[model samples]
Target chain A: MEVALETNAVFVGIEYLAIFVWGLSGGLSAVRKRYDLFSILTCAWMTALGGGLVRDTLLGDLPPVGITDKGYILTCLASGLVVAVAHPEIMRLKWTMVAIDALGLGLFAVNGTAKALAFGSSGMTAVFLGMATALAGGLFRDLMVGEVPMIIRDKHLYAVPSLIGCILTVIVYKIVRAGTVGMQWEMALDVVIVAVVFVLRMVSVACNLTFPGAVDRGGGASS
Target chain B: MEVALETNAVFVGIEYLAIFVWGLSGGLSAVRKRYDLFSILTCAWMTALGGGLVRDTLLGDLPPVGITDKGYILTCLASGLVVAVAHPEIMRLKWTMVAIDALGLGLFAVNGTAKALAFGSSGMTAVFLGMATALAGGLFRDLMVGEVPMIIRDKHLYAVPSLIGCILTVIVYKIVRAGTVGMQWEMALDVVIVAVVFVLRMVSVACNLTFPGAVDRGGGASS
Candidate 1:
């Protein structure tokens, strides 16, 4: 029972950290656009909570924790406030922000999949839910500011790492659930998967890796 | 019980019609952007179902009808296909499309509020949910195309009528639920509210009505 409690606490802590980092990313986006404080906060809350909200809704989890938990809301607001007041300072830490954001992506991917599986979702559905939970926050922030979602447009590895992490998480979860492994093993594997995903994201960014764009249809084709 | 069944049928029909019309609007937007067939369908589905999905999630109505109901999906797909194959014809009927879209807004507004109330949401929350149900589809479509949502930027009325309709729906729903009026009366009043909202939207469009823009802070002030 104590082990279970510790596990829950650890996951909750990760969730809060992810929300704060994502909120900061959201605030930076709004500040870059020269929006007011209210809009900045709006972006922060939406970017931090939107993905989880969608995942929970899809998985039949009502009254999602993002809205119900005071900590989540306060953390999001604080992140937004920090960015609004000191954007230049935040901007100076560009690489640090990117690393934190990548870590948040991995955290969200694992957390979302675990929750979805706990809710009795199929492995396939849970993987998609996890990816959505990792990606939808940034998607919301971009959409609010009338920009094409960078997940699709940018030549960077965002969705790929999350997808890989989610798939691995689902595999490990199933293996553990089937009694092939202990709870501790599953937890350890989850951490490893998240770390690998983070590392993969960082490498992709460093190398500027990208998927091929649209195929040539011969109408002013760039390809 | 027979009356209740008939009322459900009526609302179901309205919901399907609203989905179809909104899907067409989405498809039109995609076509105007010269998007491919898949993207047109995506836009249609998002615009037709996005609002209801958000509303249902917020109201704790899990496994939202937009995903579970085959009729809704089929209607949205059919609308998209119709627009894709005959966009010129669809564009030629601009006024007809506008009228249908306005009527759809009213239908969605009433339907969303009714569902939220059924799910035990507060009256105030239901009003916002209803407005979201009416407006979120277009917001999704606009965002997909990287355009500012017309609900915020357009000169013509959109949200106002939806807001009025939702407020009226919530008031009438509460009044009827309090046992002061019958279900039939509530249904009748709902139709009246929808009609009023439709008329209000059309009048606003005809008159080119607009709300005041953001307060000018003298930074290249247009006001």
Candidate 2:
């Protein structure tokens, strides 16, 4: 029980970090569009919290922490304010942003999967929700800005890494429950899964790995 | 008690109609984009159920009816298939579609506000979620098709009508609860409110009513 409590603290810490990074990315999008202060802050909040909101909602978690939790809300808003004031050329910090984003992705995917499982969701549902928790924020951000969501448009490794992480988390969770694994071991495994997701994402980026395009766009029959 | 049960039946009937209309609209969008069968079906389902999903989640309703109810799922899928097979000239039936869509907007707004209040949400939050429940589906459909959401861009009388309906619903609900009004009277008022919303939306569209564009686009100092 003590180990579980400690692990929860670590989970929350990473979640906050992920939220802040995602918020910055969203704020940057608004800045690029030259939107007003209200729009910038709204975009940042949506990008940081949208995924978790969806995940929690699907898992039957009420009054999603995104809005109810003062800490998470403040972190997102502060991140937006920082970006609005700094207006840093994010491209210069592209690598750093990518790294943080990958961390956030892994954290969200693993944590989301675990939460879904705890809520009695099927494994398939858990995996999907986990990916949704990692990706929906960016999707909402893109929609707010009138852009096609990068996850859908880009053929990059973003979603694939999240998918892999969620699947592994579910597998590990099932094994831990079925075996005599201690809480500490389970917690360690969770961390390892997150790390693996991060590494896979980074490697994909470095290697320029991507999924293939649709076999034929506009070649199919109408309707 | 009998009146309350009858009113609930009426409410469910209207909700199903609203879902079907919204699904058709979403499927039409995907069809126009020449999306594949899978994409069309997905888009339809999203457009029909997305709003309710968001609303229910925010209101702490678990396992949203949109996903868990086989009836809702089948309705959405059937609507998609109909659109796919028929390839209806939606524009030629523009006025019909508008009327039906307006009906849906009113139904969703009123139902959403009522549900939020029942769930103990504040008046302001209830109003916001009500509008969200009416708008989110179309927003999701637009995002899926890579377009700027009409709700955000068109400035049409669409969202305003929903907002008005929700506000009115809340006020009436409060009055009914405060006074010694019978359930039958409250039910009548609900229907009246929906009609009012429908008429308002139709009138606005006929008059080409719209909110004004941003007062100052690109006027602010660089972030």
C-alpha DockQ of every model: 0.13, 0.13
Q: What tens digits encode model 2's per-residue C-alpha lDDT throughout A1-223? A: 2222126777778789889999989988877766655456667888999998888776767767565667787899898887777655453678989999999999989888887888888889989988989999999899888988899986669999999999988888788888867656788888898899999899988998888765666776435
Q: Which ten residues in a row are the worst by lDDT in model 2 chain A?
A: A1-10
| Candidate 2 local lDDT, B1-223, one digit each (tens) | 1222125777778778778888889999999988899998999999999998888778777678678989888999998998898776655778888898899899889887887778787666677678878888988998888876776555357777787898988887778878867655777887887899999889988987765321333333343
Candidate 2 yields a Cα-based lDDT of 0.80
Off by over 4 Å in 2: A1-7, A36-38, A62-68, A89-91, A211-223, B1-114, B122-128, B134-146, B150-223
lDDT of model 1 at residue B76? 93
Number of clashing pairs, model 2? 0
Supply candidate 1's per-residue lDDT for A158: 90
Docking class of 1: incorrect
Candidate 1 lDDT over residue span A1-223, tens digit each: 1212127677668767778889988987777766556556767988998898788767767655555556787899898888777677667788988998898899889888887888788999989999989999889888888888889887888999999999999899889878998877877888898898899999999999876777778777753
lDDT of 2 at A175: 81
Look at candidate 1 and give me any clashing residue pairs: none
